[model samples]
Target: MFTLNSQSSVGHNRARTMPTSSAPRLLFLCFTLLSHFHSSVATPRHLRLSVQDIATVEAAQPARHRAKAKTTFFEVDRPLHPPRGSSGPCSTLLLSHSFALTLTKPPVTTAYSPPSCLRGAGDVSLAVLEWRADCHGVQYDRIFGVWLGGAELLRGSTAEPRPGGVTWSVHKDVTKYTSLLATGNSTLAVYLGNLIDDTYNGIYYANLTLHLYFHRKAQSAPTPAASAPADLIVPVSRSQPLDDGLWFVVQNGTDVESTRVTVPANAYRAVLEVYVSSHYSDEFWYMNTPDQNGPFREVTVQLDGDVVGAVWPFPVIYTGGINPLIWRPITSIGSFNLPTYDIELTPFLGKLLDNKEHEVGFAVTNAQNSWYVNANLHLWLDPKASTTAGGLISHDAPKLAGGINSHSLDGIDGEYRATASRNISATGWVSSSRGNITTTFAQRLNFANTNVVSKNGSEQTINQTIDAHTEVGGGGAYAHQLHHSFPLYIFLGGNGSGTSSQRLMRKVQIGFVESRSGAVAGTSTLRNEQVAEAVVVLRDDQVAGASWRMHQVYNYGASNGACYVRNVTSVGYDVLFDHDEASCGGTARR
Candidate 1:
């Protein structure tokens, strides 16, 4: 139940933290219903279009801006391949190749219209997808989707092979969907899934491009526009599935994921795309995944109940010398850039757009375990000067009153323990045209563990821990701030005569701030950090379920930054946060 990749990203197989991890049709008929007699002595219909549908309608047109630019290849009459010797850095069409394209128009201009500005400034076009590391017998991490006229326009996570042929890129800015590309044509498709089907084993190679960067709109205001102030351009009206950008799925624990956003028709600004996918519950025993053997998983996001964002994903480490792609397509491990959990709900969007009908909900705690979500809601308006409507002027969510607080501990000739906790709090506000956008949040989670098993069975030791915290805030048209911290620890030891020990951890630290107050007020800040650590220790004597002699180590890193300061001489701010962290452990013996 995970077919995503029709095109949508701004961001699976696995043994580690399991929870969650399809075509055809065209037939036209305009019948000539039983008139068999005098009304028709001859009726013949002709409509032929194939040659791969006429080269996918001439490659879906519209990708211009050529005052003299060249580097084309989305298609040139198909049939392409050259270079199977697979040399260094790989590309020669990538040790041989495959080709197909069809995306009817989307590099706009010629006065294209449709995107009523939920926030899209420069259609400064860009599209790149290149791969050239044949990674011998690849495994997972190859999932690229770009579709059109049928939905989805860009996804992530690709480019891994680096045995010398280098060339693994993935960039997209296609003007964030210029209203699905101004006007018409969009049947372009490309999909490369993982869990390989042994296509000659560990295989993947690619190339795709679209870099227009149109620049012809600078002709009428040449040099007379330096006046210094202007931030009141209001005239927005969005509502009507807003051009399809919503997807949903939640498993086990009574699956909960609802939708109904309609506060447009003169709104004053809104943006939501909180994509969630614990790869579908990590992969089953029904939910709460990522512990094939142990360690990896930190996510937090809950809206309608508020808590906005907290993430720590990216545990892709395999430093055992050779690399058969990633050991064979399992869930590509983590963060190749297929990342999500993004939030910016404009402090509840001026009381949720004011036009009415609202209830865009989402949830992902540790209870019942099962998640796979995609939430989209983007809008912007002023209703002839935005007086800011109403909703949630006062609220508080703190009802876990009874759930998840398990306990266990004992000591005799051996010692042991296990504990858990899930804290929650949601604050509130709504009423903006000038202050009262208050939204405060709080979160706390703690889980601990220690174990030992051996009465004559030999050896084993496990230690696990996680502590999480979240803080979020919002106040009016523009002002947000978020603080997040994730802590984790895991250690695994073995023995029934076998030898091996491992340690894995995932961490996060986030700090964000945004400011605005009338006339496009300004002040933006960002600090995002991520870390992954792995330690393997083994002293094998060869042969036993599997030889063990571990001595491996890896560390991961990530960073982010942002800035803005425009409301002239004033102050503004905002914040949002969600949480999930606090997992103890027990389950790792080979």
Candidate 2:
């Protein structure tokens, strides 16, 4: 859907609110730091078929024929890195088999049972989850999540379907949830909210499988200590709601989504894993008018009433974002599998070890309309102590620095700039089985954004960048360090002709770079870049002609000699060129 009208109105109002002076620098600071912290594949044929017709055809065809006809669309990314060498013996468990998901139906729920071969096996080394889905007809992109024992294991978005139908699969490394999967009679749930109406009639058919790999007696390499999974996993989410996602919706900056949790008395380490997505008014938060709070938003984590950490989220564009035509075969970087953030909560474990319930909350600093948020608490237990004691020694978190400034504005044509930075640190000591261990956590984040609106709002451009670093050390544990950066540039404009003969154009360049080291996970680096452009001829809001082109390059490497590189280019729905390599050389320089 085109949103030029809303954007133009927002720009006009922002200009009216600006000072009449001719100065080039007009600062508008609104910083409240309460927070802690804080794919393509497939064929070239074009066929028009209804949802039911496609399903009937598939049912009537032979299994081999159906497999040959189905086309899979996916994002280019590295595959899950399981233990090298022979992974001992492996067993596959079916979580769901071709389950139909719709708006009126409840989530698919099934009881999980450990494979008979691993009924009492304790050498399970890795667990991987595979999800596959197919849809036809016309439908909007929808969000979905998978949960085991009420703890979320995967959160993703469905691809928008076409008339010819599309199929895709996602493979995720779930080794961190080994403890949860081992529990007997645990409930497994999958939820995908879809609509079936006159205009949109696509129904999502999904299948989920879990693979468990046991470690061989003689291993080629040892698992890192930092890679050790949590002993006890806790859900920091809504209780009694196993039918749908436990995510909480926040409408504004004042809205707080929180849950009370009580950790085990013997727990010595804690970390919160958060998942978030924006929708409705905040979908294009990067282009929001500067006078209307600008385009800066942060997610804050709070322990009880104190801010513990904060997260400046990566602007993940969904499949249907902007012009949907550009994402036909190749979707955005995080469109299929949204990335999750980790916040070290070990510093606040002392306050939670009193055998009492404490609140863990999340909020968006400048949120608007709607945003879904949830988290999981991972706790490590001390085997030698039935109970542990610790205290928070120091916590230094200040308000956000920098804010929005209006450089120039004239009748919906103006320039706006925004910048912000934050630093947070915390230290604590715990007396556990390993003696008195002291731990410290530190994080730094920087952000910059510029928005230019010209030609009476017909021409709009945005440039934004975010850099962040985090570290955790002490307690004789290997130091953990993580660095990441997100750079985005977008240009949306239209020919200054009349509405009937107008031509709209859009260009986008986005990158996601991340590196992690120390701990058991070893060292790893990932770089993903995408450049896309689209042009459409619209007459009275009806598309008359359209064309799109996209190019993407992905590179990933690890200290264990695991390297993967892929480059792909596409025009419209046809893949022009696709290449794959196993070399990671020179990836760090990009």
Candidate 3:
């Protein structure tokens, strides 16, 4: 549980007169109480101050921003060190990214002692929390907070009150504050000070939550066709054409387009999607999420299936030629075992830097229950080579082959077996500025060898074998691992140089190896591991202030988990973050 402690200023106060807002003692008290109450089921209380609190917060005076009309009470200090690192080529790859910060007020150190106790696990748990004073009906999770406007930190209440008998209350529900925000006039006077231990301060880890609401303002009746120029483009196939100067439609067809995504380019990998309205009167018509949206996947615009391109977002756009694949079937064995299938869609051949769209077909045995079951192909961009791999023949691969793919199992049964495979060959005609048209075909592995097989719907199998004869031109390989069950142990190749450089792949493969059972009905220990690249993006869109906002995107190169934020801003925004979150039914809207 979280608590707050604030008292009148210690120093001698020089009496000063000024127009001010009242302090909220009742509300602050209520927050303290809620923090303790929510300890069991929910997280500690997120102290949200009202405008009155801001007005009354005094180091010695009533408020500082009294005369200033558009200033906030919370001081948004700049980062100790600017986030700008060595500016290399902006990547459109599906690699892990970091969203970390260095605190300035107290001067945090990188070598701080690791917590002795498991964080966010025991009595003192950590949760990413969020609270919005203005809106409602927004869902937030840790890692990502979605708010449109400014956000603030709510400190404890002030000692004095502003004009009239308007006293602020703590340890109570500040429901009245919402009304003040709706009316467009509200201030928060937080008695900013060092956070205490009893309170949520100094806790290295905590869950982030959100307090949000959505109250729609009345507007004109909706038109059947509310047409506005759309910036979002979903690609259908590799060959469909896209406009050179920004916007255009790419048709989905039987033949996927072949193109070379030259290295070192700034591009966005996104998908074109369709959403059905849930309510007729709903205001927002479409959704733009970094998490959910896709029905087609595992699509490599190559001549051969072995050379695959993975798109991050479903129907991801190809801003360049390089695209990688990040897809694997997860199998569960039990009374309700499902069929297994194989789809080898890695290798491909196409035009260089071509912009086109074409629709591909998708099928699912069960639509309502399992239609999308992550059936869509996995797409990747700007896949980096593994450092461990010694060295390879070339970065661009025409024909590729895969080997030693792993499989996951459940229920101690190889009963319900299934295997799915998809492959596309790569073959292309190339034309150069200083040469004749050349047709390139390298004997690489075809997609037929890669397979996902399970037996009797029980034991699950994943295959990554590519034939040597598959024709691929410009694609490289990457490998990475993901998390599975408990008792985790990862294996590193001898001397950490076990991967191949010529066919270099990102180390993203974590296969479950062995299981140790105990006396307790089914106690067990599992292991999984993979190595891959993690990215960190620092954006700079200079506004008229000392402080700047940073947007971080952490792509794991594969599905792992889901994420969300718990708090909201004065405006409406839900913050959330997670790994391997699937589309729709998975955690946090997938």
Candidate 4:
């Protein structure tokens, strides 16, 4: 069964008055929480603000303007890092041309062949995939996925379009799929499930390409002794493109989407990568009404009939989520590029290598409707052994431990607090050519959410946070370790009694932090924080006067001497300042 876990006190904190200054007090609070993780490191001086600076910023606030729709849309996310100077020339291949997507059409399928220039290349230093799309007219945000040889490579969502048009692009690092790309001839599929009608007339047109950067100097062959990427990728999805998507849909908590597969007898290591998205009534799951389910959900992974792992997804708000005015040009984190979860499956390799088909399943605990779920099983084959033997040493996964407290004067106006947590661990040993390798996996997850509604349901506030830590070890060496934190806060309210001459206000502060270290992938840290506040006046269901402020900071650093820091502030569709730095120097500047 799926479970939830979290740590925090439960209670409703009185709402504070929204700050009127440019330097929002909520931004300071968010920075305070982020500072705890950088205690051992030096935080950029510019990131710290003083009273005088706050006053200066407040004094420079621009005057409110009549809110009007815009034709163009974009985000402040930084572009992908370019190839290093040492890396030689790069080759680009067009994977898909202009492809139109709609609910009446099936997945766009095509054959993929490696570029002739890369056939004799010594080695690839890096590989990147880029997707560009454009749309116009009215439509709701839609989810899409890309697959190569049946293995899902990317999962993302489209931006809500305006009357004129909107265009956006996403770039992703795909070096992990080097083996898959080297295949002789493989089928590539792109699916975007969308509807087109008289009211919703938007259609998505997309293009995709792949770039491979070759190593400047010939590199030595990879050694077979150390733990490396999987040798085979098996898709746990539909076999043929008979529908709009290869993923299975789960409508309720008990629904399970599964697939059967067989692995090679020589496999010694395995990992499952999952992609999930909630839609319909569950799209805003974080703020759902609290009940027996406690306003928390978990995507569970099953081996045969037993639960093995679970994913506590982040709350990603699409462009059309809540009030569209708040996200005009600044989409929420994880909105364009949805995050994927990984589950270490080495402990179950023994059962998967029996030369027989086994079932791999997915389900969402306390789910409502319209959740698309699928996975890819990556298996590492022994280089010198024809068959491998292993056995499960121990397994322990307790059910979630927590509950919800609801206090309400009326059903529509009340406060709800929920908390949950889970601790899981497993150990196993495999005998291969490299020797008897023991693998251990452990995970600790926690979640907490508080919802408050008042003024006869005209106002609502939600504060939620999730913390997760995972570790995978082989023998005495750590293979991988990751720590992630998700913090989200939202306040929605309306002023005036009537629909006309009323004003709507929204305040949101969302952030994601990730730190990873181990032998397999190296060490890296990334943090992205966004804060936005907007007020829109409505006259006859149309925007009249409007004002908004958005501030975002993205910081990333890797052991390979890669660093990217960018900070942006915008007001009323006009960017106040944008600061970018490629080096890990001192602090940023305004």
Candidate 5:
């Protein structure tokens, strides 16, 4: 007769990549939890028997004591299978009583879909039947396999492996096995039967250890592949009207609405599902700040697991301003530190409007100066909305400003325009190479031009020019009326005594000036009354292959009088219409 005693512990989601070091982390955690669950317990009561009492009982029940009272302990160890998914099958061995328990004969097995919530249930078999013969007529071993999931081991007859099924072998010392299900459901079974078909003559044991040796599965579960790239920018109007108590207009340029999200302490990344309308892959640029009206800056950006490389399409515009600073792309992983920016200093310092008719979502970060500044985001779009209205799909027109002279109303078409009317009466003097050319002249001019289209598209244009000249002779002062139309101008005339006294050779001189300005969008008022004056040099006169110093425009406007003030110095080639001499006259005087 044989009896058995056993101890049990449960486990889950073990790593199948092979075990290393001491116990697995999850395995240790599981044991720790189990220890806590079963902390208050004593050893089995049977061990309390005293020597005298044990001897008496043994003598009274000699045969039964020799067998029924025996205790057996065994351990089957291996790496745990998939915690929640089907574990591709692997090989295992069973050891008992320090003996090589050979499968005396083939075993039968029944299988079915294992229940969920159990570890590798779909990969385990329900019950298996095996038997053997010993000196005591015939012997049988009913091996039962216990699983955490839905399963019950039972006895069965001999059966062969199914097609594509994993096989289990009984080695002299170690057994090898494999699982059939590599991807989906699994089944498990153990051989169970009487120690002997000839009842009275054989031994029967209820519980025994079936050591499990883990053999790596033939194939592992395949992982999914990575995906493509995209970006989303939500725009919200922070106009005062939409600020409605619940939302604050912290910044002007944004695609988010107020009341749509809350600010979090450390929010960095935001996911956007955008469908690219064009096939162009542009370097993404966000409004680095909240000021719609700003000298905005640009910071590099990356999303959707895509590495934004050095050069990309769409020349990156920060949309928030002109003097863009720090515009670059994120090219590495560590750069994605969460909460790397502060929302308070960010353009996201506003709330979102939750209008039901629009496509809307909240933002996870404002990324101002910090790593990840959490900010709320809301957005929406409607086909019925104004096309010129700023929205995800719409292209808004550039803002328009009024011009001078003409009533501001006349320039309302929103293009750059200006008008000036002036009355001038004056007595002038001039010195030529030899003598003074004295003259007096009075004149008034009015100039205005509408439909002004600037280099960009402004509605008004203004042109003012003035020309006056005088002649000298007979050693007497005479007055000459000089008529001129231009922005501003003066003239001198006189004849020298000796002829060909000094002949100056053709000389070329170049001059340069530099200007600087903040990149604000609106028209900047003139800071000084003087304007650039330059001497005209013919296009053909510019030395071939010689580099010329060009004026550094301050915010795209020419500064008055200081640098480009000589006749030849003010010359420029009409490069677009082929090299043609274009010139102006004046001296550098700021």
Candidate 6:
């Protein structure tokens, strides 16, 4: 029962090699909204349940428990196989209620400027799954992910010791994914994206169960479709590929409309989902070398020349591992698995539903190589309510206020220090049921990167670097609002001498938050914050080797100033991890 809304990872277009890298304005309109739809609520009632252990193929389904009698209870358990579009058949496991081994590192994350990520169906109580290994053996990095229907639930690095003998458990208390679980039969899948099937490379044992709770008193016939009976249903315009599964080519510094929609009149809400990725694995070509990885990048959505939204991709691990270099010929250096981003265009529906042809474009910024992107947009209209409308109102492009980067090369020996600063802000007015919704989006970022390298004798080199960044940003409209600031710290410094050199990489993140008002959804409130760190140190001499540590926490509460309920997850290995790290929210991002 993981519950967080989906997390996104940085995607690169399909490229054989990493290449190189590389904005605008809007209008003003002020108008008020018309009517609204408020929500209702209740307690816990399971329609059916089964409490038997799924030890054999025949025992995979849950036992039957009828809601027919009073005082009757149900025991919800894991299913033999997860529903479709889950982790796939290759990674599912049935746990026998035993957990051992210890987590080594939390998870890596990359998020964006946000105010709120709307809620779905319900909040599920999951039997957090935590798995461990005994004498496992493997070198490459495998990314583990969980999904509900088409929406991603979570992603993390795979368990170490490539070949495992015994397995343990690390459970997740997920939030923001009730729709995928509460609805009659929702799909939940978990898998390792390392391209390995369960039958090979390692011995793994898994035990996981998701139990959903719903208020029986408020249950109604399935809710109507998002845009039915009330207004208009229009396909608008689309130029997508016949087979969207195929990647669309986009060279660096260039962008693609890939698809555009001619919005129809009376539209109440417009929803867009962008499927994107990048094609650059320069890290493999020069592991840990300066500039091996691309700078911070954002996915931009534009209406004509005016920019609307920019999203930051989560940084997940894949493509690079301790494997034979020959594998390079077959796969891109970075992960090819695609992640979709959902944008609730409710705030802009007023302008698009005008029955006129409007153009929308999707592009990637700060790209070091090619970018592949496909976009899909859907609209919901209310003929009676949305009449007073117009496009974006009072907005401007983000720019770098100032910063610096300096490097020196003395033959084979070199030293460097780098820093970058940027400021981005936009303000607009949206017509909604709550009257003229004054919406403003703003963001500021500062990054500090430093590295040192030295060559010894014939073919040996020693390198060290410290890279850190901080960001503070958020947005709002009336009583519905949120603001958060976070800092990221990473350390990669070591000396490699021939066969066995000292290698270590450590990263920490603090003060990351996602907060929203119930008013935004025309309902209740929600808040989510993240704080975590990871450590990896290995010395060929064996004296400096250390374990890993990592964690992520989601917090939800009332906007009226109340304490938040936290869903906390932690993982570690032979390392002393700190869950309560200092908050770095004060650092300037603008």
Report the number of the highest-lDDT candidate.
2
What is the TM-score of candidate 5? 0.14
- Model 4: residues >4 Å from true position, as ranges? 1-79, 82-101, 120-122, 219-228, 291-294, 476-478, 540-542, 586-590
For each candidate in turn, the TM-score is 0.29, 0.85, 0.21, 0.83, 0.14, 0.50
* Candidate 3, 129-224: lDDT as tens digits: 122121011111011111111111121111122222111111212111221222222222111112222212221121212122221224222211
Query: Which 10 residues in a row give candidate 6 its minimum summed lDDT?
Result: 37-46
lDDT of each: 0.31, 0.72, 0.19, 0.69, 0.19, 0.33
lDDT of 4 by residue, 183-235 (tens): 75898888776665555567777788887776555444453334334678899
lDDT of 6 by residue, 354-458 (tens): 667677776654343455454546454433564545455545556422222323333333443434444444444445443554444444444443344334211
lDDT of 1 by residue, 130-248 (tens): 33223433233333444444334444444433222223443444434434444433233444443334321345555544332322343322211111111121111112232112234
For 1-590, candidate 2 gives per-residue lDDT tens digits of 22222211101111112223221121336533221110010010111122333233235434543443545678777766556554634656566544333443456778787766564324667777888889876566777878888788888788766556788888888888877877778878776766656766667788787877777668645544446788889988765444445677666777788889999999888999998877655677777664334588888898997788988989887766666666768888888788899999888778889999999999887776557788889988887889999999999988878877664434456676789899999998778877788888888999999887777656778899999999998863746899989999988777945656667788889999999897656798999999998877666654455678999999888897888988889886678888777655543221
Q: What is the descending lDDT order? A: 2, 4, 6, 1, 5, 3
Q: Every model's Cα RMSD, please?
A: 26.8, 8.7, 27.8, 11.8, 43.7, 17.4
Task: Predict model 2's lDDT versus the native.
Answer: 0.72
Provide backbone clash counts, one per model.
58, 12, 182, 9, 75, 56
lDDT of residue 460 for candidate 6: 18
Candidate 5 residues 371-415, lDDT tens each? Answer: 111122211122232211111111111211212321222222222
lDDT of 6: 0.33
TM-score ranking, best first: 2, 4, 6, 1, 3, 5
Candidate 1: stretches off by over 4 Å: 1-269, 272-326, 329-337, 342-347, 351-378, 382-388, 399-590
**How well does candidate 6 match the true structure in TM-score terms?**
0.50
Compute the lDDT of residue 88 as modeled in candidate 6: 18
Q: Quick one: best TM-score, which candidate?
A: 2
Model 3, runs deviating above 4 Å: 1-414, 420-422, 434-471, 474-590
